[model samples]
Target: MLKHTDIWRAIDRLAAQHGFSASGLARRAGLDPTTFNKSKRTTSDGKLRWPSTESISKVLDATGASLSEFVTLVGDGTGTNPLQRVPVIGYAQAGSAGYFDDAGFPAGSGWDELLFPSLGDPHAYALEISGDSMEPVYRDGDTIIVSPAAQIRRNDRVVVRTRGGEVMAKQLIRETATKIELLSINHAHPDRSIPLSDVAWMARIIWASQ
Candidate 1:
């Protein structure tokens, strides 16, 4: 007897509790910003649309909310979660001077601040996607959250910088003792294999605003 309205209401309440709008919540969960939009909740013919279980699972994981807590939200939509304000920069700017420290942590000036859901990574920063090089998966104007301190694993999406100041976002295919292989998100782009000695830094991408 789960009503569509009730489910959507719960999502709205959950976003508000975490200091986000519906779109922001969707982004934090690595989903399209319109996933929970009111305009997208029903078809033009007026057929109701329910939130997908996969989307729900991602949101719960991103917010660190338990299934029991979400069940309570579905019924009563009550609770409050914390928010964090993180440094923000453009992807292109990330390759420039004075933007980061030697360890790839946010540093120097020219950084804006954005209110985001707390992910518990003190070094987390936001990077705004700029071009079609990462299109389809991450379109232009999308914002991604990067954590320099997070552990990097195979197949994880990441942002990397080279000693020559080239910055790119790609999936980590593999990492050997001497080299790192990366798969580009855009099929048109070729994959990369860079020597470990030439990489200035590499950080995992934890979330993205589509």
Candidate 2:
């Protein structure tokens, strides 16, 4: 039996595959930007709403995708969809309450998405650098992909959030069972050392788009 979720999720997957958000894809299809938004998935009375065939056809036309391809997407998005999807959030949002689980996976709803060619950890995510704090190597707007499941090593670029509410990116200087030393990417910023117990979580940065 074909579930409605399978079809819509396929559409979402299709939009993501093309590097477009659900809203962006809808706009490209000459439909309302919210055409595929999750908020519209259910009705005011909690009834499930499906995308109109007209809207679907429009999207197919806009992307030059044939019905056969659409069917493929439907099957692909169907729980069996074969792609590594990453959740994305801004640095500020990353600091916002309840955005990430203890292991650093996205825990909240409505996070933006990233489709990587491959990802080892399903929990891996990309955080957009917000300030020039990581200048020279990483600039504002650079997106760093972090994998919590990846092993953290000495001298690797990492994102660390402390229990006291400090979140920053620094090169790993050194680490021990009791403490961690970090080197600021910008020389202007001084190196920091903190007790490991004070750190909420730390993840190595695997990739960054400069």
Candidate 3:
């Protein structure tokens, strides 16, 4: 029998493959952004929550993915190449101490897990968007996959953390030996230029559910 986690993992992978987070997938399907969030996977009383067939049907319409394809994603997911199972957390909690190592990998507990098509990254993790700080592009409740081990490049989407424990997801504009420039994904937030010394670490955002 297909477990609840297995079904959810398939939905997450499906969203990721189509450049969406679970919330984005929900939005695309005309559902509330939080419909697919991990926090909704269970009830306040601790009972398992399953995705409604209506929501799943909406997602299928939005992604143009057949039920068979979703089934393929939910299967062993270990055929020719094994899927990479990545840890996940909400972006609001990303700056909390002990959730990440000095190198920016998921370290402590409080993380959920999801399977993704191989990205060859052992340090890859997902962060769920919490607010509209990155609106238009990344709205509230969208999820993004970050690869700490991946190369940081100009013009790439990135997640940057400051020594002060601030975490931001933005577009990389320029990076020099002394400082880096970043463009805001949300137009309302002005661009930023911070000294390299102020940065704890910067990781490339390989994928996002938009």
Top lDDT: which candidate number? 1
Each candidate: RMSD:
10.5, 14.8, 12.4
TM-score of 1: 0.66
The list of candidate 3 runs beyond 4 A from truth reads 1-78
TM-score of each candidate structure, all chains considered together: 0.66, 0.61, 0.66
Q: Write the per-residue lDDT of candidate 2 for residues 163-187, one digit (tens) a residue.
A: 8667899999899889999999999
Candidate 1 clash figure, as a count: 0
What is the TM-score ranking, best to worst? Answer: 1, 3, 2
Candidate 3 has an lDDT of 0.82
| Candidate 1 residue lDDT tens string, 33-55 | 99999998998999998787568
Model 2, residue 202: displacement in angstroms?
0.4
lDDT of 3 by residue, 1-57 (tens): 235776788899999999999999999999999999989999999988878666776
Return the TM-score for candidate 2, rounded to 2 decimals. 0.61
User: Looking at candidate 2, what is the lDDT of residue 147?
Assistant: 84
lDDT (C-alpha) at residue 57 in model 2 = 71
Pairs of residues clashing in candidate 2: none
lDDT computed for candidate 2: 0.80
- How much lDDT does each candidate structure score? 0.84, 0.80, 0.82
